[model samples]
Target chain A: MKRTNEFAVGLAVLLALTVVVAGALWLSETDLNKQQVTAQARFRTVGGLGVGAPVTLRGVKVGRVEAIRLVANEWVETEFSLDRVVELPPKPAVISASASLFGEWSANIISYDPPPTDPNLREALAESDQVGGDAWPGATLPDIGQLTAQASRIAGDVGVVTQRISQAFDSTALKNMQQSVKDLAEISGRLVEFAGAQTTRIDRVSRNVATTSDAFAGVAQTFQGAVARLDTATSDNQLKDILNNGRASSADLRQAAGDLRSVMTAARENQASLIRVVQQADSLMTKIQRGNGTLGMLASDSTLYRETTATVIQFRELLTDIKANPKKYLKISVF
Target chain B: MSPPVASRIAARDGFVAHIGRRSLETARALADVRTWSPLLMGQMRRLGVDSVPIALFIAVFTGIVLSLLSSYIFTGAVPLYFVGALVGKTVMMELGPVLTGMALAGRVGASIAAELGTMKVTEQVDALETLAYDRNAYLVVPRVLAATLMFPVVTALAMGVGITSGWITAVNLLDLSTPEFFKGLKLFYQFKDIWFGLLKSASFGAAVALMGCLRGLDAKSGAQGVGQSTTRAVVLGCEAILVLDAFWALVLL
Candidate 1:
């Protein structure tokens, strides 16, 4: 009975211990039952990633880092055991130590297409003892430190630009700009006044021009009347009549000039005859001076002059008698 | 010096000497593996198999409370499934083993101390020594060996119960799906977490048994001494477990 009791007790303890161990294993969730593939990757830096960190494919957990060690004192060689169910792309790329929301780091495969079916590539991959290329480092969300530094730099640049703008708008430049605007306004005001004066002058000149145009119109009307009169004279034969009258006047003038020339000739002949008579008279006067002519002798001899006077008285008496008796003294001969 | 002060100093010195002697005795007892092997089975049955019910109870309640609190606290910012991770981590790394050790300290430590104290007070221990039997090898070694060997088993059981209860609470009460709860449970779990818990539990078990035995051996004559020894065993065992837990955390983590 004692042995049986002891045996039962032993069995119970064994069973409880087994249960405890099995429970621990279950809680741990070790991949002891599942098949896993060992893959290796090399990195320059692991970025605080350690063994047992989750290996994810596009944010889904697919494996875990089994080991990490430095190789050749330069690169970190990480060996991970991925579940066989996860199919890796032919060129699967990984990002090392991507930061999570809670600041924990994880290894993530950014691309996860199926492996190439090419046998040559598969053989090469196998021979090289590599699954894919090195994972891109720092491919996670932007680091807070980097963002802060960039923000600070941008803020500094903005400050510099603001300062430059403030400096550019100093009092001197502001005053110059204000003066330029004022000058422009004053010049515009002067131009407006000048334009007004010019407009008044132009109006006066326009009125003068109108007056001149009216006078020119009168002159043009007179010229038109003169041209019409001249055209009438030319077209109506009045000019021909005037021309005939002018010719007749010229003929009459020529006839009068001939008559005048004949009269002058007759006058010239009379003048010669008169000149002969005058010469005979001049000779008789010379004889009288020398007591030649009767009148001259009478003037020169007083006695002769008395006798002639008596004779003239007799002649007078005779002429009176003839006048009283006309037929008496006159000779009537028709022959 | 005052009487009270002198007595206090003397007590402290005696405690130091007792601890040193206990350690020496334990080391010496470890050399007698052949004699201790036969007694380990009975002690293991008592320490491990007998303690499962209370350990499970504590563990189950711990899991439910952890799940409820974590769900409440991390509902919005964290995913609902993280409740399982929280419970698993707590049970495996801290609560399951530590709570089980404390329970055992109260249950097994008190009993061992009372039994040994009674034997000491009644002169049974002296009789065994007079009979040329090695008392430490026969009594202390078996108890320490049994407790150290069995504590991990109890801790593992506690861990299982705690995780299961946490899973149930998370899925049913917290509205987390079964798959999500399980994913979170296994999300951050590692083999080292279980190993570390078992190692700490083993150390705690040894400490509890050793302290109980030491206190009982040092008991005064009478019923009062037996009671005092029993109380001291539980108290010191609990203290040792916490201290060792902190030490292991510092060294391992």
Candidate 2:
């Protein structure tokens, strides 16, 4: 064999071996020189996350998941190796989420201080915090496929609701709604008219109130003046002299009241005679009203009124003749 | 005994005797490794090193076609970066080994069978036996050992070229960036995938060389027999490669 062939064959084998080793290390992102720190994360679910999934800090790749195992059939614990130079944020949290729409997943190391903006992510993180251990708190975001399925379900629900709405909103319901609207419009017109009438009445009432308030203010002023006068009367010594005079007048009025009481007693004793006289007068008045006695006949007889009126007129004429004739006969004697 | 029964029993005994002879040859080859050891490097050079160019040629086009095809298939349904994933995975896991093995079967297996068959038909193998030379050690062990040892090296180089070609196609033709292509390439890569492919290629190499040896040693008559053995070696080696590919996928993967 030629030395050149041996060299070529050895070189080819060496080159192939180097490619295999170097390609694996580069693709796996494993550095033999770099020191690594191992950390464990406990999760309720890993979703599409698997071994060799990239671990990122602040969106930059820092490590990869080394192994995953189920613990007590409850939690999925993922052991990962991080570059030792990476300084973990205080209160580090792990959120495993779909890295792309193609079912790729990644673990994002985040700080719990700022918290996640999404309420669901926040709740998941809170639940993970309760999984007490040295392991970092880990939460799994719903995969893109799950989100798509949920959106599809929501669309189905909306479609069903829309179909039901279309079924219920038939011609009859439309007519009923139109009738209600018409009735509402008519009621609104009537209310407007009623309000117009009430508005005038309200204006009148407001004017009356204004007048009453003015009157009440005057009365209040008068009362205030009276109160002031009363206060002055009470303060002055002249009010004491008036009170003394009032006392003396009260005694005189008391004596007069005693006399009045005696008179009332005497009147009480003559009450029967007085009542008999009142009854006789009442009888006379009743006869006159009934036109039954002589006074009643005179009141009722129109011919007697006429005859008396004629006799008075004739007597006036005779008196006039006597005056003239006596003057002529010189009958001016004191007979 | 009936004549048909006698013939059936005779066929069965002949098959068993063939199996016994093949076993003895394999045992002799192993026992006399020193006698065949020197021929191993020359065989490796001819079989593995010389075979690298053709394997790499097949791998490059396989990568380019796979990249373009995956881009077409995953156009809107999946991200463009997944083209890289498809190209990398298919080349490393299946195409790189299987295609390289088939190409080598046509090249190395046919040549081995033709050369050995010509020797057998010309009484060169008989002359060796008459001279008390162990032909299995002198001929079969070295070829099989060289093929087995070198198939992985060639496969590894082909895998590297295949991935590189895919990356170039993605960057140039698919409008994908280097980082984007590499992102998807590393997405699902496992170190064991390389080992699995190498193991399958090694098995294919052994099967192809062994089948060629068996067919060549069994050749009869003259030039026509040599041609027939060469054809059988190429056909049987290809079939063996496909069967081994499936077998490795099931057993290891």
Candidate number with greatest lDDT: 2
Task: In angstroms, give how far residue A51 of model 1 lies from its true place.
Answer: 3.3
Residue B149 lDDT (model 1): 82
TM match of model 1 to true structure: 0.62
- Give lDDT tens digits, candidate 2, residues B1-253: 9999999999979955874687578667778877787788899999999999999999999889999999989887888988877887898899999999999999989989998999999999999889887899988888988898888999999999999999999999987999899988988888877888889899999888887887898889899999999998899899889988888888987
RMSD to native, candidate 2: 23.9
DockQ of each: 0.25, 0.49
Q: Could you give candidate 1's per-residue lDDT for residues A43-147 as a string of tens digits?
A: 656665677678888778888777788876366777777889888766564556545454356777654234335554334334333433553221223345556
- Reported per model, the fraction of native interface contacts reproduced equals 0.48, 0.74
**Interface RMSD values for all candidates:** 2.9, 1.1
Model 1, position A14, has a per-residue lDDT of 73
Top TM-score hit: 2
Can you give the lDDT of residue A71 in candidate 1?
73
Q: What local lDDT does model 2 show for residue B89?
A: 86
